[model samples]
Target: MFLWRALRSEGFPFVKKILLFALPTRLGGALGVQVILAALAPPGQAMLAEDFHRVLLSRALPAAVDGPDAAPAPEPLPSPGVPPTRLDELRKHVSKSALGMEIGPFHRPICPKREGFNCLTVDILPRDQLLQAYAEDKDVIPFQEHIEEVDVLLSSGLFASVAAYTQGQEARVQKAEGSLSYLISSHNFEHLPDPIAFLDDAATLLADGGFLTMAIPVGSRCFDCFRPLSTTGQLIDAHTSGRVKTTLGAIFDQSASAATHSGGQTIGDRNYDVAQVAVDACGGMIDESSFGALQFTHEFGHSGGIHSFVFNPYSFLLIIEDLQACGFLPLLRVQEVIDRPGQEFIVHIVKISEASRSPLPLDAARRTELLRQAIAYYIDDLNATRQLQNSP
Candidate 1:
């Protein structure tokens, strides 16, 4: 070992770097050691080429006191792209101590009961029935083991699913400051006809600073590739018109616009090639024989079985920003929007800031800029998906 040199603190300014290393004070693996390393050259000699700083963590490191940061004002022009943080990914973000609700968690519950997660599930079918429905398929057989018990069952529609949860309205109101710390869904948010109203209801169920995590399919990358991106105007119209059931137009669009999922679809952890039927721009999806029945039934009747909305990351953010800006989603603000690489994207929208009931309009220029960026992103995403599928 080189002989240790004791340097004066005043020489630090002229020195090249300060290195901190932790070595045992004694040769025998004992833990109490705090150290600082300094390499200094003589006045006439050239400075040693070294790293500016290097710190190695060892025994007795200082503990950190974590605290929350002050909430910032809402963004006027929300970006089309908001990346993700793996540190606070879906599973990690779900608090074990607090209650969480997962909607339509058929077989694969994100946080299973065996994993010690405090999660309650809501679905249209119970565990056994869901198992029966999806059991015959060899593909979903492996995940059948993880099927959780349905905590909340919605038979008719999802518009009142939150309010219709267990323990009645009186009890919910008593704890209405927020009943759940987190609410999650997988590929289900787009199914609701009145997504805005569902979000408003979600606001009622979610506590302050709670999170809503959703893993939704990207229209550009999935079977919905041919569908038009759900616009702010369409969403606003749906919300203001009080759509309780799926509209006939929405049903027609869902069937007619769905392209083959074979292109670049991902199933179980990036597995592909589910649907092999090649089609020309989603043509012949709705047969003439089925159109009359579909139209007659879904015109003004109960038709909540199809995807009422289609989205990509940019379009999603645009809608979320518009909703928040206009006070439609008064309690929720977008926390982060990230893609899961191929077929879908995951978003963590948090109810951190509560706004007034009144709408807060954004400037015309800002709104136009956001829309322009979103359209560009949509085109780029679709083009990239096509390129990827065509690649060798």
Candidate 2:
């Protein structure tokens, strides 16, 4: 660790934070000296912390390796008679022999590098910056070692404040389409803007019969209890309308509807409805940073990091079925669902060839009845637990 006594002078706080963030980069490489020199820009021309941080990221990290070599994860891997009881157990089902591409594995990779599992890790930031991002909150990872190596820095160009970059041209720089054996993510599916687009993209990355195992936050069981469940129309509109980045409506709703679930124990802010607060403000004026409010005047990328979509497992299944029926996501099929009541649900989806395709009912009445039944899954689970807890 280079002591930045020369650069860490008293007056400039940005310098200190920038230098601290820069410390963990590939500082042993050729650009090591340049980073310090860059951080120490000419007197009046200092860059903002994020700008300087981006410059550091623009420097090369390790090249993304080709995906792991393995056979496809077993076709229709038998669902455990007893489902996994904890969120971490979601990783237990991922085939160690399978080559996997995992998304947004920020610090908690399902198939960690240390474990010797074959994975192509994709995220908004590389490993070192990921560590710096979580430096202040040490408890978030428990140990620094949990942060795994990021392989492919893929961004849907959604988060502009933090753009993902890599050294080479954006091609299949590491692996080819339909090359992966399986895909995995934990607690990431709900944050997507156009989930169908994402699923379609994921389908392209996997070989036929390859699986995508994802853990979705349960809307009713979590802080989103009062928020509206994601719909097939909303999911489709985001993709079809090309509002694939976080939408303005999403920003407004997030600012207006987000709740404090206090770790799924009690609804914290249900009484303090912010839509009323927005109305009480001047001219339907909500906060400027809100995606639906003033942020549109800025850029598309900064408008993200909002959970633009929300879902319970059942609602997700219903939407996936509808999307498939509509031929939106033609190749992906929902296979296994295991719910941990009051927490999240892990769904294992597999990619199949056209021969395996089946249409889900698209009739309005049939869809409504099915969706209502799906929504009831969460409501029933919530009421049953609440009634048991309240019983004398």
Q: Model 1, 388: alpha-carbon shift in Å?
A: 5.6
Best-performing candidate as measured by TM-score: 1
lDDT of 1 by residue, 1-392 (tens): 00012122213342322322233232222221111122222321222211111011101111221333122222332222222343235653587768887887776777777788788787877888888988788878988888898767776444355455644753323343368878887888888888887787677777666778888787766666667788888899998998778887887776666555554543322233323424332245456766876778776555545789988765787787787687677656565566455566677766653432335466665566556655655555544445444558
For each candidate, the alpha-carbon lDDT, in order, equals 0.59, 0.57
Identify the runs in model 2 with alpha carbons over 4 angstroms from their true place: 1-82, 85-89, 157-174, 261-304, 358-366, 381-390
In model 2, how large is the Cα lDDT of residue 32? Answer: 25
Q: Please report how far candidate 1 places residue 195 from its true position, in Å.
A: 0.6
- Cα lDDT of candidate 1 equals 0.59
Give the per-residue lDDT digits (tens) of candidate 2, residues 1-392.
11233234323355455545554433133222223445454641233332232122111111222344222332332232333445345664466777776778776667886788877677877889888878888576676777777767655532221123223464223445666777787777777777766777777777876778887777655556557888889888888886656666666666566555323335321222222221212133455434334454225346435678887655776787688677777767565555444456677676776555556556675466456656655455444445444457
How much lDDT does candidate 2 score?
Answer: 0.57
Residue 289 Cα positional deviation in candidate 2, in Å, after optimal superposition: 9.3
